[model samples]
Target: MGFLIGQTYRKMVGILAARFKEYDITTEQFSVLCRLAEQDGISQKEIAARTVKDQPTTARILDCLIRKGLVHKEMSAADRRSFLVYLTPLGRERLDVLLPLEKATLAEIFAGLDAEELARFRETHLQLHRQLDALHQQQEA
Candidate 1:
């Protein structure tokens, strides 16, 4: 089951990467961008938490985005220690381009599935995610 799910995720990522070649962004980077798009001005630590990424890895990704001029980080006014991350205009423009690629990829990936099957698949996926989350929390405890 793990192999099957991993292969499916890998293939989907491969397809999206190929489709968005001009962006020079990996799926991980795109994920960070999408998270920031939904919750802009969030702290790097918060981004890490929300993305289920470690602080160092998230920081490294944010550094690359900063270098690319796609994201900006500012010292948090409320927390003297933390920094807030937000997407720049360039990042938003890139998202505008990437969103269509994502939608088209989903359309292609689910081309044959009927609505009922798709709904069931989505529910099952969510259940799997929740179970995984619980497992992780147990390990942490």
Candidate 2:
């Protein structure tokens, strides 16, 4: 099951990456952008947490987004040492364009699954995530 899950994840990333090629964005970058779109002006640490990405990885992804003019980092007034990330106009426009494509891609991939099956799949995945989160917390403790 782990192997299957890994393969599915790889395939999903590959498909999304290919689709995003024209936009010059990676799957990881798109994820950060989506998180920012959901809530702009968030600290890098918060973005990392929301995206489930490590600090270094999130910083690198943010660097790329900044270079692409999709995002910009500003010093947090509340925390001088930290930076808040916000999506630029270009980033918002790109996300607007990609949102439909993302939905269409999911629809295509899950086309064979009926609504009930899709719900069940989603529920199972949510349960798995919760279990993993608990295990991670236990390890941390």
Q: Give the winner by TM-score.
A: 2
lDDT of 1 by residue, 87-139 (tens): 99999999999988899899999999999999999999999889999999999
After superposition, candidate 2 runs with Cα above 4 Å error: none
Clashing residue pairs in candidate 1 (N, C-alpha, C atoms within 3 angstroms): none
Decoy 2 TM-score against native: 0.98
Whole-model lDDT for model 2 versus the true structure?
0.93
lDDT of each: 0.93, 0.93
For model 1, state the Cα shift of residue 6 in Å.
0.6
What RMSD does model 1 have? 1.0
What TM-score does each of the candidates earn?
A: 0.95, 0.98
Clashes of each: 0, 0
- lDDT score at residue 125, model 2, on the 0-100 scale: 98
